[model samples]
Structure formats: structure tokens, C-alpha cells
Target chain A: MSFSRRIIIPLGFVLLIGYYGQAQSSYQTGLLPALNVNTKLNRGWSINFKFESRQQLQRGIFGEEHDQDYEYVLSDLALVAGKKIGFDQSLAGGYLMRFRGQDMIHRLIQQFTIVRRYSSFRLAHRIAADQTMSAGASMTLRLRYRLSTEWPLKGQSVDPREFYIKANHEYLNVLQGEDYDLEIRFVPLLGYKFTDSNKTELGVDYRLDSFLQDHPRQRFWLRLIWYRVF
Target chain B: MKYIFPLFILVLGTFQPLSAQLKFEREYRLKSREVPPAALEFMQALPFTKKIRWYREEGYQRTSIEAKTKHQSKRYSIEFDTSGQIEDVEVIIKWKNISAETRQLISKQLGQNHQRFRVRKVQIQYTGTPQALREFIAGTSDESRVTIRYELIVKAKTDGQFQRFEYLFSEAGEFIKRALIIDQNSDHLEF
Candidate 1:
């Protein structure tokens, strides 16, 4: 009875299946394909949970045409708690889960992002953290800024069709070269506004890249983007 | 021969614009140091990051990484000679963050949508070479449609997350309205 055949066979099969699914998921994909679940649990409170299997491959079979090629896949989970200070300013913080392959990365990063909104502009800043993967770890002391903008086209269409733009800038002072580098993007976004409390974002964005000194070679080239929010 | 080469260099260098814009279309394997003293000097001044092995697809060269910077972001491409002398310093591109108006519009759109619409799919493509985008949009004297386009999905209040917005940008990276793509919704809203 202690070693019941029923329990043994099914348990062993389940374990085998779990192991196989995980095994095949590796090397078979570019990055860890995961899911992102975002919910507004309550007013001024939200949850951003993500789970990704992290595995970064630099210079794989895809690197022949180019010199360097890599991909990063990761899963994370986070709970955000915040309150609206002003009519449009929101302050929030949360926890996240870092995953590598089938293993869970233990580094926890506590982040504070300021979601400040004006009647016409909404600016979000990381306030404290540089390209960090570890908890409370910041790369450089300089501040990193990310700015996003949108404009509604009037008389053009009765629809909620508006324009969208986003910008991310990183200030780095490495090896004593104080520098500021920026990457800006703009998308003539089309939004659908509802009479009540419904809105949707649909548009294509053109990404143009520019690099200042204190910077390096990157995709700061022109790119195309397709985005949807409904 | 040496004297002639130097003379030619001086003549062309003098006529070059005070500031030139660089494009990635020229070469896949970018190595100004690919030649001589320029490489030697850049290597010497190579900041700590300069040693941070970067390739065409990886490192800072990743197209997406560059695209993520602000619209007003600026990139510089410098070439040095074997003797460690500066050969050329050109502004690859300069961009500023999207206008404040544009950002507000996106925030409003992302904030109000109540449903999770399925992405039929997504893609962005360059109309042609940077020169082509410049020539097509610039060669014309009018401010009409440009070669560069912004194509995206548009949703309808009718509840179907279906719609498309296509905008064109000129070679100078300015918005062009005549090139816009707009259509009507099936269950149009009658307000």
C-alpha cells in the first residue's frame, strides 16, 4: 500500500512530462516566451506580474550574417502599490520575479517609477536604478529618463485618433567621460475614444535613433513599430 | 602621389559641411580602424566601453537599442587613423523626444482602452534607403507625403479592435499628413 502502483506510474509520468516540456523549450526558441498579466486591483493600486524563462544566447546560428547576435528571455512577477498625489501624478512600487531557463533568479529589484501626468503630457521616471537586474543595483549614478507623448488630431476625424511618441534617455559618465545619450521615438498613433470610460490605441510608429558622444553603436537607426491597446 | 592625395583630402575636407550626418547603409562591417592611424588612435582613446566588444547585431549596435532612445537623441560616428589621429567625426543622426502633445495622446489612448485586443500582427519597414527617403520627400518642393511611413492598428468604439493608421515621415523625419491612411468603422458611433 505504501508503494501503490497507481501513485507511482502517474507521478512518474507527470514528472517526465514536466521535464520534457521544459527541456524542449530551451534552444528551440529565441527568448523565453512568457506572459504578462497586468491588473488594477483597486484605485491607485495595480499589479504587474510577469513570468519568463531567461536564457540569453549571444552569437548563435543567426550571427553569421552579422558579427554579434543575441536574445534574452525572462519571466517576472510584481505587485504595485501607489496613490495619486495630484490629479495626474501617480507614485507606485512593486516586487518582481526573475527567471533563468527553468530556474528562478533570486535577485529582487525594488523600483520607484513616477507616473506624472499633465493635461497634455505624462512623464515617467525611474528615479533610482540604472540597467539593473539585481535588487537595488544601479549601474551608474547618473539619472535615466523616459518620456512619452501623445496628441489628438481634431477636425481630422471624429474618432479618438491621436498621435503617440515615446523617448528614453540614459545619462552615463563612464571612465570620466560625462555624457548624455538619448533615443527618441514617435508614432502617429490612432486612438478610439468612447463616450464612457473606454479607449483604444492603434497605430504604427517610426523609430529614429540618435547617439551623442559618451555613447556607442546601437540600433539608433530608423525602425518601424506596430502597437495596440484596447 | 602622397602630395596629391593630401591635396585632394584638403580640398574635399574644406568643402564638406560643417556637420555631416552618417548613415548605416554604407557598410555592414564598420571599422574605421579598418584602415590605419584612425584605428590606432581610436584604440588608444577607446574608452573602457570602447573595449566592450561590439558587433553588427549585438552590443550597442542592436537596432532596437538605438531606436529606444529619445526622439531628440543624438549619435556620433568617429573614425581615427593608424597614427591615432581623428579622421572624421560626423553626427550619425540627431533626434528629440516626441513633442509633448504626441505623448499625451498615447497616454490617453493606453489609459482608456477597457479590453485586451488581439494584435492581428505588427511590423515597421523603411520605405527605402535613407537617401531615398530624403530624395523622395525632399526633391519635391511641396510638403506632401514622404517616403517613410508609420503603419499601425486602429480600434473602433464599435468594440472591434480593428483599424489602421498609416503616417508618413519625410527624409528630415517630419510628419506628412497627405500620406495618412484613415478609413471608417463598420458599426460607426453616432454621437
Candidate 2:
């Protein structure tokens, strides 16, 4: 089969499944847009600033009344500092402030990452721990591990004016008060590199959560991300 | 809230013109059919028949085709011109594979060049006539007709900053030239 067919067929199948699954499961669809800016410092240190916003377009429970009205959800602003620990490994810590309606939540994050480079693709593994605190709520602690891979659609490496594919699979273990749950997420993105330090990606961010509950919830977000490095 | 959209657009617009000054370097995989017939034929003449992958590299004012494979547990990379003529063959080897004298000379050069250095990869490169190269690999001929060189990927601390370089040395360990290896942006992955 041709390369385009290989990619297009699976993507179409997933979208079809998502469309059909709406009838059998509770689903929420939204738009997630994010911007990340990175700056390098001396002595192997770097800083990153990120802003992300979520806007809901549809929400409903299966077999019930569905709401189609657009709603603004939440936005997050984060700042992170990282230090290179090895040739392909890094350690980072960050703080994120989330704005949802009149409430503001704070999150602290620490993570370790390793990036492996192959001839055709690059794979990244990340392990993270985070604590989220909100007004009038107990703190929520979560542990997460994610594996992501990126490959050039045309060549061995992604270069300026090139397109690439990036996919991420992540598992989250969440604990809040006396309750615990697991959430799984998968993100598949098509990216375009404008320069060595600039790129954009568009993709689907799918999440399945509330695993320990009687009813599970699914979210499908059309995600757009822009990354800039200096 | 209404002004945010326009502000974001303005910010993006300001960066668009800066992209023209950036550099471009890329290496991508190629199918067998995309490779030149001469290059494919050269591979066919080799005695080792393991899985071979082809790649096309563009950057630095040059374009070249490379074939990579593993034979007898050693990784081999053969580079060819765009027209499919053989340029050189490189086989991954250990530092100990170099002769004692050559190793000493190489160490001396590296010590003088950097405050501290570590070799990440070492490859033995061979260049010769196509026929001679094939025979040399097949063990049918000696090294008389082939020119041998050592290629090393090294990470060294120089002037308080660490950088990665690709170094080329003669078979006898005389330093020839070196080029800095540019690293790709990993902001997306790291953050």
C-alpha cells in the first residue's frame, strides 16, 4: 500500500469509530489550542513558557439530551525550567496555573525525560509526578508516564518545510482524597516544521477517564499546538 | 478577551519573517526503487546480504545517498554520490580496534584540543575502487588498494562549553578535520 493510504486509512477508521462510539458512551468534544516558547540559558539550563486553552463545542451523555452550545472551558499558563542531565535525558520542574471560570487551580510538576534517536524516527519517554490544589478541595496527586514517537513523513529527519507525524500514549494514575482513578490518553498529530526552531502541529487529543467509576467519560479534543525555540 | 485574538495574531506575524534566516538540514529514508541503479547494483555485488536501508541526506551544500546495514553484527554505512558512484564505506568499530600507536596519537590530539573528551562512536572508513572495495570486504584482497581512515563522533568540553563534533583522522591517527554536529530542536519532546 502507498504511504498516504497507510496513514489516511487508519486515521479515517479512528474518526469513524469515534463518531459511532458517541451513541454508546458519554463524550465531550472540544478544541484545545496551545503555544509553547522555549529559551536556552547558559550551563545546560533552559526555560519554557506555555499557554493552553480549551473550548468545548459539544457535550452530552449517551442516549440523553446533548448540548451543542459553545462554552469556554479553561486555560492554563505554565513556566518550566529544565537541565540536561545526560546526552539524551533531562530533568524538569514546572508550575502551572489554571483558570476555570471564577476558580483558579495550581499545579506543581516534576518530570524526567529520555529521548532516543533512531535512523528514521525519534522516541521519547517521560515520567512525571504532579500535585494539583484548588480552592476548597483536597490536593490531587497524579503520576504519569508517556511514550511518544515522531517520524518524518518524507525523509529520515524533519527539516524546514517538512512534515512529520507524532503520536503519544500516556497513562495517568490519579489520587484525590480517598478516591483513585486511572486515565489513559492518546494523541496523534501531524506537524509541519517551518524552521529548526519553529513548528506547528494539529491533531486529536483523546482521553478516557473515570476508570474506577460505574460510568466512564471520554473526551476528544481537536488540538492545535505551536512551538517556538530561541 | 476580545483583544487576545488580535494580539496573538500580531505576535505570530512578527515571528514569520525571522524564519528566513534559519538553517536547514535533513536526512530521510528512501526506498530501493528510489535509489540509483548503480548504487543498488553495487550493493548486490557485496557478499553480505542482510537487510539494507537507503537514505538521502541533504544539507551543507551537498546531497548524497547512503546505504546502512548490519553485517556480522557490525553496522556499516556506505555513502554514494547523487549519481550513484561509491564514495566510502564506514564500519562501526570499538576504540580498541585501533592500533596502539594510532590510539596514542589520537588520544594526544584529543587531549590537546579539549579540556575533557569522550568518544561516542568510532567507525573505520574505507575508500577504494568499487571492485577493490568489494574484494576487501569479501576477504579476497588485502588492504593495499584501499585507503583507511578513522571517523569519530566525540563530545568534548572546549572553552568551558561542551559540544559534539565529527572528527576525521588518518589511519595512522593524524587529525584531518572536524565539523560541529548540529542538534535538532527537542522542545516539543522535552516539555
Candidate 3:
């Protein structure tokens, strides 16, 4: 197949899907900014810290002919220690602190990741489980599975100052107070590696929460992330 | 219609896999400043430059520097040693560019050397001083003044095993050197 057909068709498909879904669901636009710092201590040991801020549109979901207003919804900071267990496999454990509308929650998380490469792209699989605790709310346990893929737009590999694309989907199962709910998320991102130590990503986060109060809730958020390596 | 589109997208997006053949090749990008000044200066002298990229490759014994660029609708790659000395300059060429005699010689050599082999890539290379190349590229010197070689990437089956090797041959298709690739590590995970 030609390069144009391989690229243009898939991109057109993604845009068509995004446009078609907006007409079906109550979609709200939000903003997320995140910073991630990674430090490698040795061949197997690594440390990472991440801070993210999430803001939601104040108006109703998909309100027309109105001024755009945004309000802070939540913020989170997390620290993780990771160790390589096998080739292309790693295990990480972390602690996260979240602040949402004057309420705080502490979470403990463990994750396992496996990555493999193909001709011009890479595939990553991550499975994680976390426990969340709050002063007044019930304790919650969540399990998540995410599959991600990335491809370089040029050359054999993604070089410095080159463009790439990433697409990922995640499934979440939440257990709280004898009740369980499920969530699914899709993200399509465009990324650029500015230098060996710096990179940026911009994407859309589309999430659907099923069985939330017996009704499905859909959200669309704009996500921007920065990565720095030390 | 409301749910069908999303369902179709979800199914298609989640299951579609990249369909392409992979070779045992990789590269690590380097900064322009990280390249040796003398080599960079020589390459920049070429005309109609579009893009210049630097890479570091640890092959066989020493670390080699590669500067890849596109000029006049053709790809040019120049290799240099640690001290900015020119190793070779290679350009993308068509398969028909090799003479019939040279092709026959190459096939005979491959038949004698391996049970079976497949060609993956080919490049026309020039081995000479940086100054001579600059003058040649600048159209001030004749092409015959510089020595030309052929670089071929082939997957050869030897002793009932298939392995990829980089092969160099003289203009007359006489075998010169062959380098075996031990690993395909391109710093893919660091970023």
C-alpha cells in the first residue's frame, strides 16, 4: 500500500468517529495539564514524579452560544518507584495524593507494563490496581488495563525534534461500598520530542463511565502533557 | 446510528494492527552540535540542502558518526570517524544502476558464500578525502577522480541459519568486508 493511503485513511477514520460521537452523547470539554519527571538510578531502578491539574467547563455539557468558562475540578501528585523485572517488562509501585473540590484522597497503586516493537511502531500493555481512601467516603478499589501504541512519522525511529502519534485505550473497574462500576477511555495524541530531555504531548481524553448512578456519563477533556528526564 | 458509529470505531480502533515488514535496523538521533565540527562543516558546504540529521552508531569496534540529509530530491549520508575524518559518503541509488557484469559477480559471490541470501538495501558509496568530495559535489572535479564502492544489506543463510550482514564490495563487485550485526539497539526506550 502507498504511504498516503495508509496514513490518510486511518486519520480520517479517527476524525469521523470523533465527530459522530459528539452528536450522540452529552460531551463536555475540559482541560488537563500534566508534568512528569523521570530519573534512572541504575539499570533496573528508576524513580518518577508526576503532577496533573484537571479543569472542567463550568457551563453544561455542549452548551451552545455561550461564553466558555472553566473551573478547577481536581489535582493530583504522584511518586513512583519502578524496577525492570525482565526484557521489555517492568513493575512499579506508587503513592498518589488527589485533591478534588476541597476533599482529599490518598491512593496506593501497583502496575505492571510490557512493551514490544514492530516495524515502525511500538505497542505497550499496562495493568494496574489501586486502593483509594478518604475521610468520609468509603474505601474504593480500582483495576485498570490500558493498551497503547505509538508510531514515528519519519525515519526508522522517532528522533529528536520529530513528530509521532499515539493512540491508547483503557478499561477501568471500580469497587466501592458493595457496588461496582466500569469505565472506558480513549485517547489519541500527537507528540513531539524537542530534545533528549524534553517532550510534549497534546491529545483528547474521551471517557465513558457506565453504571454511574445507573446512568452512563460521558466526558471529553483536552490533555496536554510534558515530560522531563533527569 | 447514535451507538453504531461509536461501536464501530471502538472495535476498529482497538483491533487494527500495523502491517509492515521489519528489518534489523535502528538509529539514535544526535544533536547537530554533537557532530564533529569538521565533518559538519564539510557536509554543510553541499548545495540545495533541505534537512541535516546526526546519528551515533556503535558498530563493531568504534563509534561511527552519520549525517543524513536530503538534497536535490535525493538522500545523502556521510560517515565520519571520531576525529572528523571521512569514512565514506553514500547515496541512494536505483537497483539498475549496477552494471550487469557487477550484478553477475555479486550473485556468484553470494552463491559461493551462502546457501541462500536476499538483498534488503543498496547504496552507492564514495571513499575519499572530505576536500575531494566537497570539490566533486561542487562540480569542480570529475566524478572519475573519486573511488566508488557498493554497500549492500543482505540476509544470508549460512550453516542453516539466516543472519543479516552489511557487505561492502569494490566497483568491480569484488567482496571487501562484511560486518555482522550483534544487536538492534537504537535507544528506543530512553525517550
The numbered model that scores best in TM-score is 2
Candidate 2: residue pairs that collide = A155-B28, A156-B27, A156-B28, A156-B29
Judged by DockQ cut-offs, the docking class of candidate 2 is: acceptable
Residues A1-230 of candidate 1 have per-residue lDDT tens digits of: 22134234433543343344332221122333333344444343444444434344332122233434455555555444443332233454555556645654343334445443332333455443323343343332323333333332332123333333333332332221353444333323344454212344443322222233322222212222222111
Point out where model 2 deviates above 4 Å: A1-25, A63-68, B1-25, B28-53, B70-74, B94-118, B156-162
Report fnat for all candidates as fractions from 0 to 1. Answer: 0.00, 0.50, 0.05
In model 3, the runs with Cα more than 4 Å from the true position are: A1-26, A58-68, A211-214, B1-191
Q: Give DockQ: model 1.
A: 0.01
Q: Write the per-residue lDDT of candidate 3 for residues A38-148, one digit (tens) a residue.
A: 886665667888999999874343334534567788999999888766545678899999999889999998988877655467777889999999998899999999877
- Give the CA lDDT, 0 to 100, for residue B45 in model 2: 87
Candidate 3's docking class is incorrect
Write model 3 residue lDDT over B99-138, tens digit each, in one string. 9899889879988988878776789998887778877767
Q: Report residue B92 deviation for candidate 2 (angstroms).
A: 2.7
lDDT per residue as tens, model 2, A1-230? 44455446555654554455555667789999999999989867899999999999999887788867589999999999998776677899999999999999999999999987775778899999999999999999999998777888886788789899988778899999999998877788999999989999999998877634746678989999999999
Q: Which ten residues in a row have the lowest lDDT in candidate 1 chain A?
A: A220-229
Model 1 bad stretches (over 4 Å): A1-37, A41-43, A50-65, A68-72, A106-121, A124-126, A130-143, A153-163, A170-230, B1-191
Identify the leading candidate in terms of lDDT: 2
Candidates 1 and 3 compared: the better one by DockQ is: 3
lDDT of 2 by residue, B1-191 (tens): 99999999999888655533223457777999999999999999898779999999875557899999998888999999999999999999999999999999999999999888888889999999999898988889999999999999887877665667788999999998877777788888767
As a TM-score, model 1 comes out at 0.30
